[model samples]
Target: MALRLAQILPPVVLLVLAIVGILLVVLPARETTKTPENMYGIVLDAGSSHTAMYIYKWPSDKQNGTGIVTQHSECKVKGRGISSYAGIRGEAAKSLEACMQEALSQIPKSRQAQTILCLGATAGMRLLDIVNSTESRRVMKEVETKLRSYPFKFKEAVILSGQAEGAYGWVTVNYLLENFVRYGFVGKWLNSGRETIGALDLGGASTQITFETAEKVEDESNLKELKLYGQTYKLYTQSFLCYGQDQFLRKLLAHLIKTQGVKSPIFHPCYPRQFNTTIKLGQDVFNSPCTKSYRPAKFDPYMNVTVVGTGDGGECLASVKKMFSFDNCTYSKCSFDGVFQPTVKGGFMAFSAFYINYNYLTRLTNISIRSSNQMANAMRLVCNMSMTEMVEKTNQMERYLKNVCAVSHFVKILLTEGYVFDEDAFPTISFQKKAGGASVGWALGYMLTMSNLVPAESLGLMKAMPSGTWTAILTLFILLLFFALGYMLLIYRARTKQDLV
Candidate 1:
C-alpha cells in the first residue's frame, strides 16, 4: 500500500511543480502588458500653408510603438491665414473650425486616439509676434478654443517653437531617407564614418540650414540623437526668417544687379520682369511696353534668382558646395539639399530635389521636341530604343507623370546628379515670408517615445530577469527533488498496505 501511494504521489507532485515553474516564467509577461491607463496621442503639423495630423493608439505593439505610423491624414483651410498671429481672422476662426472638422472626419470613430498636439511654422508664429496686439492674441485664443470642441477626445493644443519645428523636419527627413528601401539605409548611413550631414530646408516662409552630427543610436528605435550643427538639438537651429519665395527673389535680384550691372537690359519679358510686373520700367517702356500689358509685378529682389544651367546656377551651386567642401559624400559629389516652394494658402508644397537645380524643372515646364529626340538618342547609346517612337511615348509619359504626380523634376535630379543642363543658364529667383513658432509640449509629446528619450524594453519572449532569481529557481528545483522523494516513500507505504490487505 505504501509503495503504490508513493508512486502516484510522486507523479502528481512532479506535475504540480512543472506547472508552477511555467507560471513563474509567464507571469511577468502578463504584467508587462498593463499599459499606462487610457492615454492616446495625436500630432498636428500646421505649416504655413496646410495642417497635417498623425494619430497614435496606446498599448502599442511592443514590436512597433504607436507614435508615428503611416496611418494619418491632412487637411487645408482655405480662408485661414497661415500666420500664427493673424491667419485666424473673424471668418478665419470658422474656416479653421471647418477645416479641423474635416480633418477629424477622416479619422475613424472606432479609434480612441486622444492627446492632440499642434505645430505651426513661419506664417502662424510670425503673425503672433508681428501682430502682438490684443486683437491678435484674442483671435489665437479663439482658434484654440474652437479646435477643442471636436467630437473626439481632446488634449491641449501646443504651438511648437521654431527650433522645434526645424528639428521635427530634420528628424522626419532623416527618418525617411534612413529608411529608403534600397539603401539598406539605417544600417549603412548610421554606421558609416560620416559624422554629419548638411540639412538645407528651403521652405515657403523661412529657409533653414542645419549642420547636424549624428550623436548616438538608441535601442533600434525610430528616433536617433543628433547634435545640432549650431548649438542645441531642439532650439539651437538657426533660421533666417522670411527667406522663402518673395524674400529669396529680392535677394537674387540685388545680387544680379550688383554682379552683372544688367538691370533693365533684359532681352525678353520672361528674363527679369516675369515674376513681378508691378515694378515701373521708366515712362517710354511703361506707356508702350514690349507687349500689350505692362502691369507692375510685386518683386522680392533679395531672392537668389540664379537659375540652374545658368551662370548663376553655377554660382549658387558653388556657394552651397563651398559650405560643405571640407567633407566628401559617398553617394555623389553634391551635398544633400532641397528646395520647398509652397503656393499661397498652402494649396500645394512642391519639394524640389535637394541641391537646387533649375534646368530639371525648366525642362519639364518647357521641354521641346528636339530635346525629346535627344533624350531618345542618349538612351540608344546604352539600350535598344526606337528614337522617334520612344521619344513620343516618353514625352507623353513625362507629361502624364508630371501632371499627375509632379515628380518628373525630382526624378531627373536624382538620375542626372544635381540639375540637368544644356549649357550655362541664369538661376531664377523667388522668396517667401516667414512666421514661425514651435511648442515644447508638442515636442515632448511627439518625441516622447523616441528611443533616445526612453529606455528599451525586453522585446521577445525573454523578459527582464529578477536579480538572484536564478538562485531561487535552483533552490525550488532542489526542494522539488526532496518532495518527490517523500512522495515516493508515501506511495511505497500505500502499496505495502494494499499488499497486506
Candidate 2:
C-alpha cells in the first residue's frame, strides 16, 4: 500500500508540474505581446509658387525602412511661397502660421512632443540664393524661428539641393506607388516588379528628372547612387535650373525684350489676340541668370511694354522653340543645354505645373491635341483666341485667363524638344498630384529620411537576435521539455509500481 501511494503521488506531481510550466510559457507571451502605439511627424514643402505642409503618422516601434509612414494630412500656407517674402523678411515666417496651426489641430497633445517637424525649400529658394543671397539666409532664419516657436519637435529648415530633390522625389513616387522591394516576417517579401518609374518635377523655378538605370550612364556626375530601404540604386538625374514654366517665361520675356525693345509694343503669340496688358520689364527680367549672360546687357530701369495678343499658334510654337538650345552634346545623350541624361526609362510621373496645364488640354478646351504632333495645335488653339473668347470659353478670372498659350506650349516643347521624350513614349508618363490617396511629391520622402525612417542598415543584419517567431519557438521548446520530463517521471513511477507488485 505504501509503494502504491508513492507511485500515484509521484506521477500526479509530475503531471501538475508539466501543466504549470505550460501555463507559464503561454500566459506570459499573451500578456507581453503589446501593440506599439502610433507616432506622428510633419513636413513642409516651400516651393517657388506656394508653401504646403504635410502631416505623417506611423507606429512608434517600426522605424525600419519606409517604416509604414504615410502622409496623414496636408495644409497649404495662407500666402505664396517663402521665397515670395524675400522683400519683407518678416512676412516669410508669418506665412507658415496658418499651416502650423492646422498641424497642431490634426495631431493629439500626447504625441506632440514626440512628433518631428521639418521644412524643405525647393527651386524658389535656390533662385533666391542666386538673385539675393543675403535675403535668402535672413528669410530662412526667420522661418526657422517661427517653426521652433511651435509645440512639436522642430528638426530643421533648409534649402534642398537639386540632387537631393531629384533623388528624394524618385523615392516619394516609388514609395507612394509601392514600387519597392519589401522584406519582413509578417508576410513574404514582395518585390515591386522589375524597376521603379522615373520622376519629373516641374516646379515654378526649376525642373528635375530622375530614373533608375542599368545601362552605362553617359555622364557620371548626373548619376546618383543612393542606399535607401537597405537597398542600393544608381539613378540618372538632372535639374534644369531656370527651365521651369515661370523661369522660362521670364527668359522668353527677356528674349522678346532684347529683340523688341520695351519702348515698342510687342505682339506675343503666347497671349490672346484681344488681350492687352502693360508690364514693366526691369533689369531684373534681363539680368536673371537664365537670360543675362546669353543676351546683351540692358538698363536696370523699369521699361514699360504693352503686351498685345496676336493669335497665331504656329508663330507661338516657333517662339517657344528658341528658349531651348539643343545644340551642344558632351554625353552620349543629353536632355537640353548640354545636360547629360540617359534614355528616359520605365514610366514617369509628370507633376506640379505639368499636370495643372496639360491635364485639361483636350477636355476643357474642346480641343484634341492628345498627340505630340498636336503640340503646336494646342498652342495654336490658345494663341489664336481673343481675350473675350478665352474669358467666355473658360469662365475664369483675367489673371487665370492669361498665360494659357505660354503654359500649354511650354509643356509641349519641354516634353518634345527639351527632354527628347518622343511621341511614342507619351503613354509611359502620368500627370498626377497624388497616388494611392497621398500627395505625390518629395516632401514625404524628405521627412522620412530626416526622421531616420529610411534606415541605412539591413533589418535582418541589425537584429541582435531573432524576434517574433524565434521568441515563440523558444517558448515552445521550454513547454515541450516540461512535457518530456513529466512523461519520464510517469514511466519511472509505473515501473516502480510493477516492481513492487
Which of the numbered candidates is closest to the native, going by highest lDDT?
A: 2
Candidate 1 steric clashes:
79
Give a tens-digit lDDT track for model 2, residues 253-318: 777766676555878777777677777665446545676654555464566667777766777778
Give per-candidate clash totals.
79, 1
Worst 10 residues of 1 by lDDT: 340-349
Candidate 1: C-alpha lDDT: 0.36
Stretches off by above 4 angstroms in model 2 are 1-37, 63-66, 182-189, 283-287, 294-300, 366-370, 374-376, 456-501
Clashing pairs in 2: 313-380
lDDT of 1 by residue, 1-501 (tens): 675465586567785775576455445446554653423345554444344444433333333222222223334456424343354455535656655665566555554444444434343445345546465456556656776666655544445445555555444433322221111211111121222223334443454433243332221221234432112332224344444433333333334333344354322111211112223333212222111122244333332222211212223333223211223433222222332111111011113222222233333334322232333232222122222333354464422222111122122222223322222210111111111112211233244333222223321211123336644764676677567667767767877998899
